[model samples]
Target: MNRIDGGFGWVIVCSAFMTLMLVDGVLFTLGILYIEFLDEFKEGKGKTAWITSLIPGTMLTVGLGFGGIFLSTLVCVGHHFEKRRSFAMGISLSGSGVGIFVFAPVVRILIEEYGWRGTLLIEAGFILNIIVCGAFFRPMQKQSGRTTEKSETKEEAIDLLRCDDNLIYIKENCIPSDKNCTIEENASQDDDVHASKQEIITQTKSTKNTTLSFFSRHFDFGLLTNPIFTIFVVSNCCTCLGFNAPYVYLPDRAEEKGMNKLDSAFLLSVIGISNTFGRILFGWIADRKGVNRLLLYGTSLVICGTVNVMNPLNDSKIYLMIYASVYGMFIGVFVSLNAVILVDLLGLERLNKALGLLMMFQGIATFIGPPLCGKSYVYNLY
Candidate 1:
């Protein structure tokens, strides 16, 4: 059901926006949680960080942000608009920035008042709204057109592309047999109906099996056969190694450098606010003629890396704020066009599978990145 720059499409954009806000809000404020965990558990930073790493898939608390709402939102936007996809993606994903802005200070205060465990419970409440947004992710609608089958012998021919109880919708609208037009003299419509029903059941079971395998084991290995895809995947893997470390450690680092917890958490808000503007600005720029999305993405990533590397030059709050703003803007550009750049490289047909595979790699990098950052921070501390 593609409306393609239509009215309801904006509704979907809004849903995506809110979804990201909740998902990333919980995920990005881990720094607030990090301080609490250390104070409560009396654990070393490296070991404590493995706790943060466990939240995504293992813990019920951080699990809200973990279920790939981030990827799913992008895929949902992909289904609706084409020409303005970059712009739509920007708006939807900018919710991450919004989440960071709203959640960081809130989480810090909650931890200070409620304890980390209490804070986790309330944060869980914040994340559950993602389910409400999930309602707006309308499924693809069938194309409308009338077709007469070559089968005067058949009552109905159904191309059952997919049939599942969870998503109960149907294409191939049934047309009743006309009063004057009958099948052959002896033919029974009842037999055809029964056959069609059996076929549908068979396809439904097959679809279930195929979908399970597709999510788990099946992928178009052919996509990896392309040299360009291989290079792209490897390059992204490299880029992601340093990407997530800062978020997990930034607030804690600020606190260590003698800033109060509130001020440290506010740094994430600065990053988030800057990130929001960056997503919008870069997304709009990508829409203009002659703009190279790949080049823009690469440049932004390079700049972000530079900022991350240079962040430790001073303990000054103003300098840290400047660093946060610069890093957040480029981070926005990277995310805004991430899938857009992929579409240019791989086209829409392959996006769903391609993105899943891409995220699998990036997720590995994300999980490894922060803990390794913790190890470095631990080393530097001693």
Candidate 2:
């Protein structure tokens, strides 16, 4: 496999960018929708929160499980690029940031001009573009020699059958031939043939059993036993516990603090801009700087967590913008580097299963996080 990095891989990136733009753009901009749902449905904060959280939770959990567009894109890009894998993934993942930047204002404007229901309809139209994006993922070609080896193996089996005479002799003897063979000899030959047939049948049964067992061996559930991978999953789930609450509620929080809708929406744009740059910057660094990716990822998470925890303290618009900017940048770093860091930890061979399981766990947290945050808000728990 020669990886043609520039030719088709870049096309895949462009498609992936668009896919993420539509999917994540709508997902992140749900903060705008949060307010709309509150008014339109006349629901309490806790009840309304499920409406927004369901999109991401379903996509991450069920979509990934069944091979969603994003997961398929990631797998394609990983297959296509090796040396520049981090950089390519950074660019591809940065689409979510760009989508957040671009869609936040667009979604707010739609809500203002057309109402929340209209905005949702328009967002659905945008999301349909992922189908177009998916078409660009050309299937990778198989190795040339693989088919040849299979053919050769078949030919060898055929030749061995052709050279064998015992079966042919048995078949010939079954017909009425005028040969001077004794009845005793014929009986012994019949016994030998029946024993050989039974042996072959037994071997065939065992081969089927072995084939079934191969899947379990190859998938290797023992990966969960590794302390590092286990710890990573637990920590990531914890991070998801609060990962989306800010995006969902930040705009409302700003409105409560006397910031207008437009200004609060722009905060997401600020986050998007910084996040876009952070993804590209960290990706470039990971590729060329030889830095420890886990350390970099952890540092970004710390910064993001700190910014989020301090979010309730700032009431000034400018201060909020600054905070949003810092938070966005580190969040971008965390998102862009997530896959690369996993590859570093688990290697590429195990990455698909590792990521699938990770997303499944993260999805559970995503489903629960926003509702909890909304309930907290109802009770002034924060």
Candidate 3:
């Protein structure tokens, strides 16, 4: 199919949405699970924090590093869309927000009824749905055919060059000549042909070597050399240092401020709903002309960071609800636009490599952020 705007692309979007819903949606429920871990394990706050941190850390680091289903789905979606790519990405990523909205209360009820371990087991079963989603990702037929045609053309050209008739024809037609051509001139033309042939062989060898070297690396580290990409990674690391702390701790924070566990869980749902709207809205805005995606992303991050910094000061349930709603919306904007902005910066060709590297850096931040926040809670409590 030659379609780039829709059709199978929408199918890929749905699959991506479902995959992210299962993967990231469950990941965000760590907030609800965090309280359960504290009660059950009774370990140090820092020690227990690892449970929530490592799951996402491993998902981003190891999963993305080795072409995790999430990244693969994204790549599939990218392949299927061009002009509407940002909108598609936004719609797909919005699943995470929707998942958070739906799962927060579900996880809460599960925890109250079945406890954390049973809840986890049930979630594990839900996660298997990703495999079903993976089935929808059919490669584009034209792209595959083009690749085969190119390879076949290369082989045909090689075979033709080796034919005696083709070589004689090339010698007669390609080489500049006169009926009274001197031996010295002929010798010089032959020398030029030999040098050109050597150059082609050397270029082919170098191309093969470069391809092999690229595949040898576990993840592409060359992305780090891109100044724009490097800046993006560093900024992401800084943002993530505090980004997930709110998700993992918001429930506990609500509970500590005198809300019941059920009510506390509802806070995540509030965030999730607003987050869903934010993602769709921002995505639409991103596709319009004259709108800068990076500026939108930065503005959202600033708003989220400010709200999180002020979270401890608010004790009123009404205020907490309002804060959660606002925070959720802005965070959703950042999440939805994150990949889209990268595509804007680097284009689609390097997106997978850039995303993998971005995930690796964010994973490092994920691992560290929660533990530090957990320790902060410990210190503040004592």
RMSD of each: 7.2, 7.9, 6.8
Backbone clash count, each prediction separately: 2, 0, 0
lDDT of 3 at 26: 87
- In the predicted model 2, the residue pairs found to clash are none
Which sections of candidate 1 miss by over 4 Å?
56-65, 145-218
TM-score of 2: 0.81
Expressed as tens digits, the lDDT of each residue in 40-63 for candidate 2 is 889888889999888788777776
- TM-scores for every predicted model: 0.81, 0.81, 0.80
Model 1 TM-score, all chains together: 0.81
Pairs in clash, predicted candidate 3? none
| Native RMSD of candidate 2 (Å) | 7.9
Instruction: Summarize candidate 1's per-residue lDDT along 1-382 as a digit string, tens digits.
Output: 3578666788899999999898888887887788888888998887888777665423222223454677678888887878898999999999999999999989988887988889999988887888999889875676744344435314443433344433433322433454123445454434332235456578878977876565555356677889988888887778766776667778888998999999999999999999999998899889888998888888998899888878888888999999999998899987788788788899988887787777766666666666777887779941
Residue 337's C-alpha lDDT in candidate 2?
73
Residue 83 alpha-carbon offset, candidate 2, angstroms: 2.0
